[model samples]
Target: MKAQGVVLATRYVLVTLIALLVILPFALMFMATFREHTDIIRRGPLALPQHFSVDNFRKVLFQHHFDRYYLNSILITVPVVGGSLVFALMSAFALSVMDFPLKRFFLLGVVSFGVMIPEVFIMIPLFQLMHGLGLVNNLLSVILPSLAMSACFSTLVIRSFFMGLPRELLDSAMVDGATFWEILWKIYTPLAIPAIVTSGALTAVWTWNTYITPLVLIHDPLKMPLPLGLALFQGQYVANVPLIMTGATLTALPPIVVYLLLQPRVVLGITQGALK
Candidate 1:
């Protein structure tokens, strides 16, 4: 009994230590946002500031045009997350529940081809396609391609969720003379919200932080999203550390806010679908 208690206590201590290590840097950054730049530099990131200043956030929001980038981020992330979720759910539903030839082949294709293909390898082709459409500096360039591209992991996850639904529920819907579209709308979609939220949360973060695609396709400074905007906070000799930290903190809020709102669904989805 004593031996088991010691082992459990040791495990708890290890987990706590690991969690603190993971959380400390973000905590330091959050604190630094309210501190003066000189204090941050003098203290070497570990010490507290002499006084709290909202000046960093104020300057970034007002003087540096961070608000526009924040808005741009929202415009890009919202559509991308919504479109990706819709596309993945619809495709996964058909792939998971329907009877068709090349069904296995298609699933294999999603798993194999989608995951293995590196974005770098296709960047040149993607840029050319964007240029041809005259979408180089447009938000549509980000939104449209995001909609069309398949996320294998999301498809796999939603497929698992769809597979877990009782076979009879779908059959009963069909027996009632419901069409596929009707059944999908009235039944499947409502039931799939939890899983969809999980997928949305994932897509939201990725689309928000997208740097390379925007860098290659976006030429206008005013149109750049938050990650690209961070570049402006850096200078040759003296980096704007406080302002950069402030930008990062502000940029991080939206996704975290979205996640908090949908956290229940995420938890429920994972718990319910864990076996799959």
Candidate 2:
């Protein structure tokens, strides 16, 4: 009993220390946002703030044009998350429940292929395609490709969950005259909530934080998303550390909020999926 107690205590202590190490930098950054830039420079970021204010946040949101960039992110992420969820669910449903030929080919050739290919490797072709379509500086250029990319991965996730569901349950539903769409939306979808949220949350964060794709395809300031817009915080020679940190904090907030809102199901979905 004593040996087991010692081991458990050591585990808790180690976990606490690791947690602090991970959290302290972000904590300092959040606190520094309330302090003046000059104060952070003079006292160091580790020093406690002399006063608390939201001036840096205001400056970042209004003076720095982060608001426009934020709006751009919203416009892009919303469609990617919502649209890709629908596509992934539909494709996953067909793959999981229905019998069809060429199914394995579709899974391996297209879905797995999308997952394995590096996003950076396709930038040139993607850029040329967007340019040819006159979507070079349009949000659609980012939205369309991101939607497709997310759908492929999400399909795999939801498909695993669907496949794990009991065969008898689905067969009984069909005997009761449930149509394909009816089984998917009314039956599997409700049961697959956790998997759906997991995929949606993951896609939302990826789309929101994407820098490379937008940089390659978009040049107009108006079309740039939040991650790309972070470049505006630096100059030829100087960078405002606090201002940049504040923007970084704000940029990271939405995904964090979304995940927390759906955290319980996300955890449940991941756990169940792993067990399967």
Candidate 3:
């Protein structure tokens, strides 16, 4: 009993420390948003401002056009998350239950391998491809590649859930004169909600924070998403520490809200998978 209590206490202490480690940077950013720019620059990031104000956030959001950046982020993130999940679900269904020649090759050689390769290696080729398509400076330049990448991971995760489903369900559905298409949508999909939600939430978060793809492809200030926009905003306001942190905080806000709201579904998906 004493050993168990000791282990539990130590485990909680470790988790609390890790939680603080993850949260401290955002905490600092939020704190800095209300602090003086000069206060942060002179006294470092940790210093308390002599007076707190909302002028920095107001300037970043309204005067400097962070709202435009926010809209650009929405334009890019929405299509990527929606399209990626659709592709992922269809592909995952085929991979999980359907049979076809070269199926293993496509899964192992293409999809799995694509995930292993770093995005940096393909940036040049991706940019060239986008340029060839006349998509440079267009939001589609970011959306297409992000959708494809997000779909790959979503497919892998959704497939596992589909594969775990009982074969009897499919056999029974078929006996009732249901087609494969119906089986996929009418039967399989309902059971895979947790998995789909999990995939979607993760995809949404990644698409929301996409920096590299936009950086490599998007050049127009109007088309740039939040991450790139924030970087440029920081550069333009080089001396204004508080304004930079305000942009960072707002840019990071959406994903944090998304992950929190969808957290229960994520946990449910993992729990269901584990039980299976």
Candidate 4:
């Protein structure tokens, strides 16, 4: 018992140390946002600021138009999340519950091929396609690609959840003359809420933080989202550390809030999906 107790104590200490190591940089970044740029430069990033000020945040929001960038992020993220979830749920339902030719092949393609291909690999072709469609610098250029990627991954998640559902329930619904759409809406959707929420939250975070796609496709500064907007604070010669950190903090908050709100559902969905 004493040996086991020592092992447990050692494990706890190790985990706590690792956690602190991982979180320390983020904690420092948060603290740096409240410091003056000169103080940060003089004392270094780890030092405590002489005075905590919201001035950097004010400058980021007002002078840098972080609020407009924030709005653009919302406009992009909302549609991507919503559209992805809607499309993924339908695709998952078809793949999970219904019988069709090449169903397994399709599922395998989504699970394997869709994820294996990195978006960066196709950015050049995607840029050409978007330009051809006259969508260069358009928010839809970002939204459409994000939606497709999100839906592909989300389908795998939702399909796993749907497959775990009791077969009898779907059979009973079918006996009542429920069409596929009716069964999907009335039966599968309610039971799969946790998975849906998980997918939506994950998609929202991915879409919100997407920098490369927007940077490549969008040329208009006004149309730029938060991740791209954050770059505007950095100059060729001089970078405003405090203001940049302030923008980072703002840029990070929404996804953080969304994850917090949906954390319970995400945990439950992942746990149940794994068990089944």
Candidate with better lDDT, 2 vs 3? 2
All candidates' lDDT scores?
Answer: 0.76, 0.86, 0.85, 0.85
User: Tens digit of lDDT per residue, candidate 4, span 1-276?
Assistant: 999999999999999999999988778878988998788778888897777778888888888888789889999999999888889889999998999998889878665466457778989999999999999999999999888888887888899889899999999988998999999988899989878888888778888999999989988888999998877656521567777778889998788787778888766655754464
Pairs with steric clashes in candidate 1: none
Question: Residues 15-101, candidate 2, lDDT per residue (tens digit)?
Answer: 999999998988887887788778877988789877888999999889888899999999999999999999999999999999899
lDDT of 4 at 148: 88
lDDT of 1 by residue, 197-271 (tens): 687676677678777777777778788888877765554214767777888888777777776788887665456
TM-score of 4: 0.90
Candidate closest to the true structure, highest TM-score:
2
Candidate 3 local lDDT, residue 195 = 83
lDDT order of candidates, best first?
2, 3, 4, 1
Per residue, candidate 3 scores C-alpha lDDT tens digits across 47-114 of: 76677778888888898889889999999888888898888888988998999999999888877875
All candidates: TM-score: 0.86, 0.90, 0.88, 0.90
* Order by TM-score, highest first: 2, 4, 3, 1
Instruction: Name every residue pair that clashes in candidate 3.
Output: none
Q: lDDT for model 1, please.
A: 0.76
Residue 100 in candidate 3 has what lDDT? Answer: 97
- lDDT for model 3 comes to 0.85
What's model 2's lDDT at 77? 95
